[model samples]
Target: MLMEKVAEILREASAEAVEPRFRALASGEVMEKAPGEVVTVADREAEAIISRRLRELLPVPVVGEEAVSADPALARALLSEPAAWLVDPVDGTSNFVAGHPDFAVMASLVRAGRTVAAWIWQPTTGTAYAAELGAGAWRNDSPLSRAGAGGDPEKWRGVLKTRFLDPATQHRLQTGARVFGEVTPGRSAAGMEYPMITDDELDFILYWRTLPWDHSPGGLLVTEAGGVCARLDGTPYQPEPPGGPDGLLVAADPATWERVRGALA
Candidate 1:
């Protein structure tokens, strides 16, 4: 119920700040956050709106991707809180800048280092995915479940971001694709992966970074939809900062997780 409310808020904010600018971004509307990272006016405006609304609804600290980027201390402040909100106003900023359709607005409620609720909204199609830990995941109010077992490693399909790894690690994984089945590079769209996993279009997703605003919400959505979510070290997942010791690896089920981990090992 709380997540649904959050989703509604995101939907409204996204419609206002995100949708209208989809393919209409002006020359100066886009700015560089980093060499490869980008930010658009839409991202900033939507995040500001969501941050204010979320704070009003819960009166808790809010950590948004754009807000934290502007003020690093805000990130630490939110993480130190017993309960706080994590918002990725526009998860796939790159795609959004490129006018791609694979983008989402996501938020998660992290209580004492654990995600208790998650909501993700796909603005283009208006599809929403929501979950409360232990209550199960849902797609637009319908109960959701992941696909059945993948047949073989050689045939398994998943999203893999080897580019995020060190060069040696990337080369090793690339040359040893036999053990990995099929690993496609994703669009870096945070919440988009879980929908693919839930629909059986993807078997797993391995990301080399674990930003809470990017992965936490989707991680719980996968776990509640009958998937296995953990770090590469096999610990239960929590929202990790910009650089953590391990990355996020999620599979459609426990068995698939072990299979993929064993392959990596």
Candidate 2:
């Protein structure tokens, strides 16, 4: 029920605020947040809408990507809350900014640093994904198969956000990437790529960044679907802000994660 309402919030907010602005920005609809990051009218307006609805759903604190970017202190403060909701108003903003169909709206509930529930909605195609703690993940209403249940991992197909990597690593990985399975990076959108893990399209995934809003939802979905999630060092991943222990490794299973780690290590 909570997830259904969460999905409803994402769907309605996207339609109302995000979709309308897709490739339709006004004079001041988009602005740069950082050198490479951005915030759009769609992102701010959609987060406002979702923040209101999610607060209505539960009285706990709401930590949105845009809101936290404006208020730096919120990031450190959220980790201490008993419960909080993480919202990514318009993930894949660069893609959305470019009119690519990869942006998504996401929400996740974290109780004392543990992700209890998550929802990722792609408004462009009306497709959605949901998962709750200890329960199976679903696409719409159908149950998703556990990892490796769909197909073989020949060469071990996975997602690696190579663009965000160091120049040397990026060049090495992208140029001679034939050795590594040509994974489709999320392009700053976990909601778009995480669903692929559930369907077993991706055998594993590797991400070096530790942004909470980006990983919280997708990580929960992968584990709920019977996959493995951890950092490169084989430690458990806790949902939190950046500036701490980073790196993420989610795979079809523990063995696959280890194999990939060993190969890359």
Candidate 3:
């Protein structure tokens, strides 16, 4: 029932605050929160709706991307708290601003530094992805699972976000990844990428920044779907209350993760 409730909250936020503003945002409604990072009025409004609803559900700290952007201390509180809600009101603000259909509203319930439940709602398609820590992962009414072996390291296809990496590190990764089948900078949305992994559309994604709102939900979804999500150093991906420790690698399975990690290393 809690999962269903969170899913409803995502849908409500999208309906009440997101969809109406898509492609219709005024000049002032979209602005950069930081260099190369954008946020929209929909991001704020939808976050408000989701955060309020989440507090009513558990009275826990509501750590949203916009909220933390406004107050960075909340991120530390999220790490210290016994539980909290992590939200990305609009996962692909740039896409949404440009009238693209890939934006999503995502949220995750974290307990003791681990994600316990998560939801990602694609407003355009009205599709929802949900996962519980040990239960499983689902796309709408269909169960999601890893179905096949990732055959060859050289044949693996994936996304590696290298924009945030330093020049030296970026060059190393780009040059080292030459052996992979096909590599591209992803669509800039973890919400979409996680689903693609579960659905077998991609073999892996290695991200250099591990922001809680950007990854917590997707991490759980990938793992629950029988995939693997870990840091570049092979530790399980854990949300840093203050947010750092780069390099998150998520793949279709453990073998693929190792193969991909080696190719890039």
Q: TM-score for every candidate vs. truth?
A: 0.95, 0.92, 0.97
Query: How do the residues 1-265 of candidate 2 rate in per-residue lDDT, one tens digit apiece?
Result: 8879999999999999999889898888889999988889999999999999999999988889998898867776457889999999998999999889898999999998899999999888788998898888889888876745333335667777765678888766455435555566655678887887787677877888878888889898888888888988887777887677767888887778777776565
Question: On residues 77-187, what C-alpha lDDT tens digit does candidate 3 reach at each position?
Answer: 567899989999999888998898888899999999899999999988888999999999999968898864458767778898998788999889988888888889998
Candidate 1 error regions (>4 Å): none
lDDT of 3: 0.89
Q: Where is model 2 more than 4 Å wrong at Cα?
A: 149-153, 171-178, 184-186
| lDDT, residue 78, model 2 | 56
Residue 25's lDDT in candidate 3: 87
Clash number for each model: 0, 0, 0
Clashing pairs in 3: none
Candidate 2 lDDT score relative to the true structure: 0.82
CA lDDT, candidate 3, residue 31:
91
After the best TM-score superposition of candidate 2, give how far the Cα of residue 201 lies from its true spot, in angstroms.
1.8
- For every candidate in turn, the CA RMSD to the true structure comes to 1.4, 2.1, 1.2
lDDT of each: 0.85, 0.82, 0.89
Name the top lDDT candidate: 3
